[model samples]
Target: MATSVKNNSLPPSLISNLNQVLLSRQQHTIDHQSTNSSSLPSHSRNVDEPDCSKPLLLITNCEGIDSPGLIFLVQALLSDARFTLHVCAPQSDKSVAGHSLTVQETVAVCLVEMSSATAFEVSGTPVDCVSLALSGALFSWSKPVLVISGINRGSSCGRNMFYSGAVAAAREALICGVPSLCLSFDWKKDVSSESDLKNAADLCLPLISAAVRDIERGKFPESCLLNIEIPSSPLANKGFKLTRQSLWRSPLSWKAVSANRHPAAGQYLSNQQSLGIKLAQLSRDASAAGAARRLNSHRKNVEIESVGIAGKFNGQQTAKKYFRLELLEETEKADDNLDFKAVEDGYVAVTPLSLSSTDQSKIETEVSSWISAALGREQRN
Candidate 1:
């Protein structure tokens, strides 16, 4: 179910009267100081400690703690005055580092600020940030009602989901049995536009409010994730679309399409058996590059040309590097039903991902029968 909010005013009424809610059972440190303290962080209107009277909305990312889009997002959330938005993010950009934890190494943490918003920069992956927050390392001694990851520079939709550290952060929260949202902003010609970012932040306001409502109502789905991709296109009048992820093989890894342009690429190509195959590879790479450039463009429709190169092998001379940024995937009904497709179509794409799936009931599925079979003895025996 979708939730909605209309006002952005600071809720003074909610602030005057604090509400103490029980924390959900999740991962955290058995570390001292938190054992007897309230599950919610102490509320201070300073934007640093913010408000303990309100629930916590922990924002995080793989993008370094100092992020323009992230700051803008925090400002937007603060304006609504719904919850204390404490930022828990990486100290540095840990891109594509999926769900990694420094089990044996000591990961440092420090307090930081994005303008006036109070934030904590963790010396680890996005997942580590979530872990630390839940453990009562960031807040005074409270857990957040909701977890938000990213406002990422590029789309973390479709295949990117598997490799994106941003999405991994949200996944981390979900695994801890908390509702989470992975927010992303599409790139424009290899850069993230301010207009697109601001629009994304604006869009997030309502979504955040809705999510908070669900959290308070205890209606949030367990072990589920919300992934939102805001396109480079301005979403002034657009709405969000509930869509599914598109299919792309091996989305977790990058595939090289063309190497002919690079100095070493030509040498590698010459090593191939046929010149025809070399030319074909070059053509495919060029096509992919052109397509990517257009996709990154803010314009909806732009003509792109296909290119191909052949001949010569020398590792000495290098050409421009080109790659296909595997962002969106195509489906038969990509217009409305796919995550990346919706982003490209200038609408916010909302995808729901769950941690586990169901299995059908069968002879092997029966618990009693499985236990008996495992013992290698029949019921009679």
Candidate 2:
């Protein structure tokens, strides 16, 4: 059996080194920017030549580009100079979007300012962001050394993974033959603060660093991606646990609402208002055309209608319906080795996931052995 480490925090030396690296990187960025401002043309500067010495890392999140979770994770990773960072994330929340794609529609990509990272906000799902980035249309590099999907707002354990856009984004990267990691904090509303997210990022840095290093050296496990769940109290957690995906699922509750009161209705009105006169004119023209067509159809049916029995109704009234679904809270007892249970027990759950079926025993053994070696003495810090 692989030995487990029980430390709650990273070593002081590692922390100090990371801080120094971050400071140096920040200074380098400032110096480079100043030099570029004087010597380089404005348009050409955006198209930076990739630094071949450093491994490229792409980040995305379901909770939009400006979310604190993504920002904190990005900040944590910036402290490591071994990687070059790029971010392409959704412009708005797409938390439950799963592996959906923007089909038959034009998805927008806008360049955004992020701390020392080449970033873009995509007007699409998390999967769309990854797909676009990997397509070589958005970034200069085609394949990154690794793709990190989150430090998502909530846990994506068990069946929740199927609905998590954060996990899906990482899965998309895995599909494209790149190694990936999906991260989430077991967030509890009103109880978990933003600081927990920062702590989670800091806690996961060692595992992320180890994965990247092993991947570059071709020693990382094959045909699998890691789904890591950090506990709510990151700083007061047990050490890492190699886990299996659980069967637990959160039940859904659907509530009905009036059409006008629906959130979609408000968004539609807001969008139409933004379109202003053009949409109004178009609506008026369409209404008039529709009325004309109805009038012609009525004329054709007038004789047949007149022939119907007096006081007989032809149309049936139907109630308008609108509903929203929410995930309901439930509690279940599961094996400690399962991802969800491991997280609940205050262990950082690292579950190896694969798209294709394989021998479960072999996978568990491989992951356990790899994690034991990677973590080792560092976990004792």
Show the lowest summed lDDT stretch of 10 residues, model 1. 19-28
Each candidate: what lDDT? 0.69, 0.85
Clash pairs, candidate 1, are 39-142, 43-51, 43-52, 44-50, 189-296
For 143-182, candidate 2 gives per-residue lDDT tens digits of 9999999889887999999999999999999999999999
lDDT of 1 by residue, 263-297 (tens): 66667556544855765666576777785664466
Q: Which stretches of candidate 1 lie over 4 Å from their true place?
A: 1-50, 190-192, 249-335, 359-381
> Residue 128: error of model 1 in Å?
0.8
Candidate 2 lDDT trough over 10 residues, lowest sum: 302-311
Instruction: Assess candidate 2 and give its lDDT.
Output: 0.85
Model 1: lDDT equals 0.69
TM-score of each: 0.60, 0.76
Best by TM-score: 2
* RMSD for each of the candidates: 23.9, 19.1
lDDT, residue 213, candidate 2? 80
